[model samples]
Target chain A: MTTTSETAQAAPPAASTVPPKAASRAVRSKNRIDPTYYWMVVPVLALFAFFITLPALVGVFFSLTNYAGYGDWKFIGLSNYVNIFKDPAILQSYIFTFIFALTTTVVVNIVALAIALGLNAKIKWRTGIRTVFFIPMVLSALVVSFVFNYLFSNTLPVLAERFGVTPLATSILANENLAWLAIVLVTVWQVAPGATIIYLAGLQSVPAEVYEAADLDGAGSFRQFLSLTLPLILGYLVINVILGFKGFLGTYEIIVGLTGGGPGMATQSVAMRIFSGFTGGDYSYQMANAVIYFLITLLISVIQLRLIQRRGVSL
Target chain B: MTASTFSKPVNKMAPLGLKNRSGRTRKSGREGYKVNWWLTALMLVASLTVLLPLYFTVAMALKSPDQIGTGTGLAWPNPMNWDNFAAAYVATNFPVAFMSTAFVTVFSVLGSLACSSLVAYAIARNWNRRFFRGSFVYLLSAMFIPFPVIILPLIKQTALLGLDNPGGVVFLHVLGGISFNTLLYIAFVRSIPVELEESARLDGATTWQVFRKIIFPLLAPMNATVGIFAFLGSWNDFLLPQMMIADPALQTLPVVQMLFQGEFNTNYSLAFASYLMAMAPTLVVYILAQRWVLSGVMRGAVK
Candidate 1:
């Protein structure tokens, strides 16, 4: 709020004078209302309201029912949710989702930040190099999953045999613990590049003067980056954290494509569980799982936004 | 000044500097720091590590079914197999899927943009001190809603409205895109001086014409940014298309690719090959638009 006020206060007055007097007056009168604006949003808002927001409302209502596609919709007050906790598969999904989100977030940031620093430094064909690194990000997550599926099932096991740990899964997503590791690893490969690009942009935007000053004080690259570069883009880092976490929560295609969420209940994330229920024509039950997942995601995001906004405020 | 004087010389004498201008510094030689030899090497390895998988995908795309399994992890095929490319397309029913995906992406992105620009223009033009805060809060609140739950209800709603038509599902894609689209465009529109629209107004142009003639052209770059995201999201999207389109004929490319992989069962070569084929649209779009992303869209994006 204060930041917005500060920005507003700092803004220069609209000073254009070349326009006709009537034009300037109308423009001045319309600066805030821009009446045409709201109408344009109607179609989009209609879509968002119908598809994104409306369905969410339906999901909430459906959670309390026993609608299984074709059956009579009997309202079963919270029974679906109560059952969600008792089911070990659902519980395993909760645990797996948390662990997957945690591992992917940490690993992705480290790799992305390192890549960002490298790209920020002098390397050949910087744009070309950034694009090359970004290739994984551009490919369909499903395609990436298939690529990794081949890598894990066909190529990876061979290497494991020669330079092996207890061959985790014959297929990466099939083994419980190894499925978790493979999902994390594959996710890191696909996601890091985009995060790295954002970080690189943040890195590039750090003023040259600060680094020059650091050098003048005899600070080495590592110290200078720590003291100067990191602090300036702390907001961006936080943004990436939120993005990476949010991204992990919705990680469906990869999990489905890679492990199909299991040899049993190994890699089935919250989304996967919800999907499983829906595919079985158990809409009401799936809606409950989805609602719980949504609320949890909303809660985490709220906390994240508050934390980041607070840090951004202070910085 | 003194540091740059030092900065240039420190880079020249590293063992790998080709000219090896060892005498303090050569006139035009770039500065050398303690032979960043390790970073260069690490970067080389990192570059390969990232590229290797993609190279492998392309390799598998060309390899035959027998070769895909028997093939060494990284080995080049001796009798390079390219027939897999033709075979993947046929097996996947890719041409039909491709058209469906294109149609869906185009309509959805356009829908999202029209919706986004309207809302943004309205707010940017008419913001009152009191109302501005309320609208921003509402819009920002919309951003807080995570996306997974949107899928389940979408399944219900699509059934309710007979949105099972491939065309009908585009709205679902557009709906999901609106939150970001509005937020981004509103920020961009705020930066545009309103006087241009006012001038058009004074010339007796309607608000629609003003937007069409003036603001829309100016907003083109930002639109491209939003379009890129919308296009890619729509093109590569799996779930909504998976759920909404029941008929195999109506299925989008990504969904078809998924079905193709499973239906093939043990024939992993064709699956990976078709998968690569599916990715080509986004890959091409990203490569073409990648430059505009950082240089054009991002210029306005960063506040």
Candidate 2:
């Protein structure tokens, strides 16, 4: 996945043109170690090893123990992992997270792709409209979720009452069966703009000549899009889907701000479950959940890398 | 290839019929380029819908408690109650929270840039070496690991090391950001020509000197992109600071504001005002740097 040689071939020509040749020359002349380059990299590697790698390894180890967050512990030896399968709350949160992620990924991609196509067109106020759509992407998730929380709890209910719309009178976040939809809605709202930007890049990269050829072939707009645009941007679509899905798996702040996993834990995500463990004294148990989450993300990332590498090579 | 091919016809045809249909001619054949007024209106309406939350927050922030309860909250506040901002400012300990947030963002951005760029520089420059190649791969693979996966032990580790403060969060932010920022910098570094570094090396500059004088300066645009990204990630972060910094005094803007919301749950105007305050810095930064932010995000995605 991290093949430098492949990247050199795939990278755009302007910046990488001289570096590969220069690097090879350096390599041929010096078979020995380059202390300077090694020195330059040590700080970064040290930070990565200590903060990221070591803690990850420690986390795996902790999952086997009966340790609270602070105090000493006994070796539990997969009991927490065993309990994870049986614990209804943990299992329910997993199901909710998966459902939320899958739903949001589908909705966000479709909305973002449509908006990207629109933004890519030669429309009036294109930049202004694009900025407006992307504004939510910049705001903190907690803040956006809070604003929407108010909208759902206060503004929507008030407007609903005024219009005599009985169904809309209740805050959606408080509805046990339907609260997940509110979380999904806010997730898509915040995430779509970033996806739109990617799709816009993909849209821009489509050759004009290909579109012209489709036009001459008498393809309608829908046919042109299906036959030309989608295939061309399939790579970007895969990237967005995998990244979006993985990101939504860690849905924390949005859920916290909007629903607080409320109305009988109907909207709880795995992340919420894990963090809530810190205060609840189930630290090691949650570490096991975290390890599982890690593995799931890692699996998705491997698939993403494979897809990207294939596409990268082809491009 | 596409740009040159597409531009040639437009350039040649400019003299014949350029003035009247310059806009139309630029994208003459594409259906999306046509002047579809209805589609334009639809898009505008959609933009308004997307902006509604932001608009509603501002409106609610300006309303008084009585007006809000009276169900005129969506309407503009009569005489626009600005006192909500003052009240929220005091309630949320806005100054301390704002300072903490600023401190984290500044240090996180700087630390990420410094560390990631150095790592990226070494990898990009030494692309042929086995060690650097392996290091690059190692760093890039870390992108796959989510924060929650490590947060359990990271919290414990921070406590043991006595780094579980705002400063500790800064350390985590910088280190956590290394993977993505390194990826971005590596892409950008690949684009930079090695000629400048080569000349600097030829003039007796050490590797450090070459990077500092030539490579680092050329990475200014990428520095901005990575800086903005790091800034956004650190400033808006909730879970890390919320978990690591237990002391209310050391909490950042988002976490503090979340607490403020809980405390002021029924104080609708004050809560909305604090929400606006929490989001104001990022929104202002976005407005000022939308072009860079948009382009950087797009570019980052493609990578």
Candidate 3:
């Protein structure tokens, strides 16, 4: 090592005395490891481990026991996991969560994309209108739900009754089959602003020259949009869909505010199921359910990262 | 990307459109297109989806119980019972809940800014180190663990540690945000030239001193981005405070509001009034800092 360092210092004229790679390696090794870097990183890492990582691991461990969130436990092996598959309530939650997420993702993207296109157009009061559109993005989701709940429950039924619309005369929140639709309406109302902002950003990134060129080629606006705008903003669409889906899968506050997961558990998301199980004496069972939910989310996140990387998107 | 990326297109394209408008009048060719009023009208109607609910909230909050029973729930109240706000404020114990929420949000924002940026600076500067690279990956992996998966155990752990309160919620909020906030900061930090830090290092500044003096000041835009996210997240959070906070009085606004909601006996006027109060701060901030908040949210979404 000493000889390598000395030779590295000797000069380029005597480069053949020692292999250049070895000298460079020795010099590189001499680069100081700052202890302050450790000081900067370790505390945050330890906190994260203690708060997030340790609990996750502990939760997974408990999924294999009959701990009841407290008391003595027996190693139950994969019984909880097996029971989860057979359990009607758990199965219903997974189904409802996936369906809700899928529907909401599709609806949000379509509405947001259309609104983004309008905002992107040459319009009057563009900034003001954009500001108005994003109001829901900043409000608490629970509050928004409660507000909409009153609208759906009281105002809508009165109007429907006056108009002689039989199907909607009563509150939809009381209907087991239609309550999820109400949740979807409120969720879309609150969530569309966020997806719209993302869509607007993506739309703004596309160069105006692309549209100008299309116009010169005798393409109409619709043709240009389908051919040029859609392809360019597809990355944002994919992102909004995946991120929105992942987010909506953890739908708790909105459901609680709207239906309290009632009308016979019709709107209970996987998150609600897990949370309710905590107080419902189904702790280890729900932990198992939670572990499964975690795996699904992990898989989706992995896929999202891969897609983003492949598309060369920074986020 | 910076906040300016959001408005750059509008600034650039508006002048182009104006220039095209002048040329189009003279030539009458396909140099420009007119503003589509149909789309504007459609969007205006859609905007009611946002406006009507808010209008309903305000109208409901101000209506007397008698007026609420008489109308289709759309008319503005003439007498305008302003007493609901006063009543709901006292019933929800608005001051305590608001302060608790403010405490959690403020600390969460401050802690996230301090801890995540420090971690990012260390990792970004020492990118060649294996341990630093490993740490970044470890932090990034936490994003995949859904909060529900760990929430139950977290409640148990925090209770055991005597943290079943708003303080614990603040701690988790900061810790939970580190992964994404660090991701955002690392990307931004990599863009900052090392020469800036090298000068400070040559001045014999320790790592902490260099970070505090030089890098933190330069991270203002990212600090805005991360701080906005942390504030909004901690402020609006329901699940954490609902399940984690043991004392009813110590709970944050969202959880307190949830508890205040009892069936069959709920006064609609008071409930709506309470929601409006809880929503007021977010609305005020958004109105005051519209540009920065909107652009900050946009910047956060893609990166």
TM-score of chain A of each: 0.84, 0.88, 0.89
In candidate 1 the C-alpha lDDT for residue A249 amounts to: 83
Summarize candidate 2's per-residue lDDT along B177-274 as a digit string, tens digits. Answer: 88888888887788778776655654445677878888888887678778878998999999899989868898998998776465435888898899
Candidate 2: docking tier: acceptable
Candidate with the larger TM-score of 1 and 3: 3
Best by TM-score: 3
lDDT ranking of the models: 3, 2, 1
Worst 10 residues of 2 chain B by lDDT: B11-20
- Candidate by candidate, in order, the iRMS in Å equals 6.9, 5.7, 5.3
lDDT of 3: 0.83
lDDT of 2 by residue, A1-315 (tens): 123334434555666535644343333233544477888898778878999999889989989998887678999799999999999999999999999999999999999998987776556766687788888888899988988887887777888988999988888778898889999998999889888877866776676688788778998889988988999989779878988999999998999889888879899899988887688898889999999888888888888789889778222
Off by over 4 Å in 1: A1-38, A163-169, A313-315, B1-37, B129-136, B294-303
TM-score of each: 0.86, 0.89, 0.91
Number of the top DockQ candidate: 2
lDDT-superior candidate, 1 or 3? 3
Ten-residue region with minimum lDDT total, candidate 3 chain A:
A21-30
Give the per-residue lDDT digits (tens) of candidate 1, residues A183-250.
88888988887677667556645655676667669988889778888888887788788889987987
